[model samples]
Target: MKTGGVLLQQKTKKNINITIRNLTISDITHQYCNWLNDKETNKYLESRFTEWNMQSLLDYYHQKNKSELMLAIIEDDTGTHVGNVKVSAIDKNHHRAEIGIIIGDKNLWGKGIATTAIGIVAEYCFDVLDIHKLTAGAYAENLASINAFISNGFIVEGQRKEHVLTPSGWSDVVLLGKIKSQE
Candidate 1:
């Protein structure tokens, strides 16, 4: 049972298409990294991950090793990869893992792109994987992410001061968690 649990935690072959696909080498060569490296995108996570080069993105993808899968977010109707999401650090034993998402289509901001994607992915994480909980953190400055997480039923677990560093300096981080109800 333990070994089975470990295997389940590492499973990553499932590629869910629909506003999200596993990135390809072309994405980096064509400047998909630019979208990811933008400050607006980084506002919630790394302050300057723009350091990642094309080869680095490629190598990182190759090195991911089934521990997690990173998917490219694309519009279902247009097939344009506008964002990305990752369901990683899967712990079948603890039945929890972190969830991260981003919608880079600046024009689509505040239009519910994120809200819908959250529902899609959360359903997969909780319903399909039977994972008991999902967790996420957003920089205190990123109200959009905070609202989306809250709207999706993620409970505010806590806050950490100076948890994120930006070019301007340190910022707070809001921790959130969603545990599946036994009901």
Candidate 2:
């Protein structure tokens, strides 16, 4: 599904306006690649395990775009490509999908951009894609990520203790889920 135009918009708690659109290959820039390579930016992300470059990022975008709904989060006032939100692992038979997000711009962290982006993508998954359930997982220590999902109505479904190995030590994986209301 190509979401080229403005899919949704929301003013973050910081009053920063943002919108999301499908992430095209053209959106994969050197700066975008750098985000994946940044230590702080990818700390909780599996991408931190890999050294990313332009070609690698482009290949990833091409691969994911084939099966997932990848979107770019844009800062409206500046029109900056600040981040990405992805709806992946779509199980059509079960009407469920996994949602993942990364606010690449460190400057925008804690600005409610992630929360607003998750809310927009969750709505698209339920209303546009006809998905009944949306799920996400975050590193136990990543409170910002967990809170972002929670702010969008995702509930804590379960936790897998010491599920992932981090630089510091093993960390739990917090699983969260949200089911569409039966209106």
Candidate 3:
């Protein structure tokens, strides 16, 4: 496909009426699934899920136990879905959570959209959500994601060897973390 899923989820100040709100229903279901399942895109992601289609998406949206949270990322000027940011396991008591970003739109890659999106979400995590610790695991082979996370105040915790696999083989996973205390 033409990465229509990415385009579908993008929500920025320029698109839609809710300028400051995150991408909601427009994203949760179909947006990332298409790119995430693609062989090329899956190369960088740690996990690849198989159970997805239009019907599966609809089913997933109705579930009450979903702990994961996602937000669509759009370019400031063009209003395009270059990627997305996510967080999960939001423990209000612990004020900790796992966070992630996925920039499958090659055309916008390396242009700082990922950085901007991450920065905004991290602010939301610490400032709005009052989360103390925000963390993520990246495929070690994906240096771009590592740099993006690290440059955004996230520090490397360690590397886990051969912890994940793509269609081809196993790859190491790197753990990164940041705390509101550090900021």
Query: Per-residue lDDT tens digits of candidate 3, residues 1-183?
Result: 010122222233333211123445565545556767667676776435564566665555455226666566665565566566767677777888887777767665666656556666777777667788898888888888888788789999999999976666888899999988653
Best by lDDT: 2
lDDT of 3 at 158: 97
TM-score for all predictions? Answer: 0.82, 0.96, 0.77
lDDT against the true structure, each candidate = 0.69, 0.90, 0.66
Rank list by lDDT: 2, 1, 3
For residue 131, model 2's alpha carbon misses the true position, in angstroms, by 0.5
Model 1, 77-162: lDDT tens digits are 56577776777778978988788887777876777666666666776677667778999888888889888888888989999989
Q: How accurate is candidate 2 locally (lDDT)?
A: 0.90
The TM-score between candidate 1 and the true structure equals: 0.82
- The segments of candidate 3 whose C-alpha lies over 4 angstroms from its true place after superposition are 1-20, 28-32, 64-66
Q: What shift in Å separates residue 163 of candidate 2 from its native position after superposition?
A: 0.9
Q: Which pairs clash in model 2? A: none
TM-score-best of 1 and 2: 2
Q: What is the C-alpha local distance difference test score of candidate 3?
A: 0.66
After the best TM-score superposition of candidate 1, give how far the Cα of residue 24 lies from its true spot, in angstroms. 4.7
